[model samples]
Target: MPGDALVHRINRIQGQLEALKRIVTSGEADCVKTIELAKAASNAIKKFAQAYVETHLDQCIEEKVAVKELHGEMRKVVHSSFSL
Candidate 1:
């Protein structure tokens, strides 16, 4: 189970997505603004994923494997996943 902090992040991401949807559906949507909103939502998603990974490493990884190398690899994978 995720903590309160992760819930907060999820709420923020939902809000961003909602805002993006509203702009896209509105009649006077600006292209730049829409792109910005989309980027913000994308960034929020990436941050959510990053935070979840950290939480998983802290709470779940200890039971399954060693943290030394696995932690580094996890971070690398997450970072690369979000990288352009």
Candidate 2:
């Protein structure tokens, strides 16, 4: 069940996307609502990516495959990615 939390996050994002789709197809889509849902989905994706990468990095470090130097590099990558 270690991945259960990640799966839950994915399901939530999927639900948001489905709602967005339903609204658009219903021909009564509220522009603000659609935008809000879209942004929510986008933020969820970013959060998921950050969590996944952090877990991977932790595993790598635990296994002695990741060096201290990689921390700085990974930090830079994560920061740059979220800056968008």
Task: Give the alpha carbon lDDT tens digit for every residue of 1-84 in model 2.
Answer: 647878888999899999999998999989998999999999999888777776576675666555766777768777998695
TM-score list, all predictions: 0.68, 0.69
Residue pairs in steric clash, candidate 1?
none
Off by over 4 Å in 2: 60-84
**Segments of candidate 1 deviating more than 4 angstroms:** 63-84
For 1-84, candidate 1 gives per-residue lDDT tens digits of: 578889999999999888888887787789998898899888888889888887886666566487677778778887899688
What's the lDDT for all of these models? 0.83, 0.82
